[model samples]
Target: MRVDRKIKASYEHAIDNLDKKEENEQLSEDEFLERANLRSDLQDLLKMEEINWKQKSRVKELQEGQSNTKYFHRVANMRNWHNSLSCLAIDGQVVRDGNVIREHISKFYAELYKENVLLRPKLNGLLQYDSLDHSQRDLIEWDFDEEEVIKALRALDGDKSPGPDGFPMLVYKCFWHIFKVDAMAVI
Candidate 1:
């Protein structure tokens, strides 16, 4: 996008310079042809840029509308309503009280996650495999350098899901210099 903007600016500047030259002096056949060609090229570039801008604007509009539409909210509310537990059966009896339901859920999960196993089977000598040597272990444990971090970031697909902060790889890749220190520290 920046490159396109720069190209557009240069083309506009060239056209303006050509116009100024035409106004100042009488042009030869070749100069007139050059001016005409430049104008045509500038027009073509501007048309393409306008189409690109319109496409981007339409996409943004669609995304914004989808996110904020009444239908979207209704569907989300419907899903929440469906997922909510209004009643539960416990000990062959229906439970509707909120406190009872909460207690039942908490007790059920607590019992489910309770450590009941007193003795677990050991796998110490059952399986034998070669392990990594010192150098390999060191390589795996070493902190990432700037090059490695940049390479990993670059390797990620920019169009994939964004991180928890809602920024995509494209953002980091585009503004690496600004984010390098913070990103490295976090990593």
Candidate 2:
């Protein structure tokens, strides 16, 4: 705590020193205003840096939570998380930002690991579908409304690649198999 207090005091002193240096310099009113704006910018940057540091600590905590498999839950309960990711549908504003996806997908992957007991060994490996190459992959396993992402992918001439689950539209195969339906309907 004392160290932290000292660091804070030093940072404040540095800011003060810079401000004093600007004040000491005799300049035009416009130049003085510009120096004041620089000081404001420095303050804002310091605030942003503090926020980034706090978020970094939170991210580590979330990672530990994921390691403990906290995100995984029964199907009925995990549906809400699935829906949250899937909500990145055509209408939502969530874009392809790495940090956003990192936060969301850590939970998603953790939940996925929990649900797929049959593939428990594969889940342990956790690297199957995550290796589609950087050019084609987002490096974050988000549930961007597959429908919309597919549309965008097509627009970009993306090849028909398999999803984290499987190829597009093939997701229904599970339903067909589970319900014991005929393939004729799909054909």
Clash counts per candidate, in order, are: 0, 0
Best by lDDT: 1
Error of 1 at 15 (Å): 80
* The best candidate in terms of TM-score: 1
lDDT per model vs. reference: 0.80, 0.53
After superposition, the stretches of candidate 2 with alpha carbons farther than 4 Å from their true spots are 1-25, 65-187
lDDT of 1 by residue, 124-185 (tens): 89999899999999999999999999898889899788999999889999999999989889
Query: Candidate 1 — worst ten consecutive residues by lDDT sum?
Result: 70-79
Write model 2 residue lDDT over 24-130, tens digit each, in one string.
87666775676577667656655665565445545765777644333333322443543564333223566566566666768778887677656556446666654
Tell me how far the alpha carbon of residue 145 in candidate 1 is from the true structure, in angstroms, after superposition. 1.8
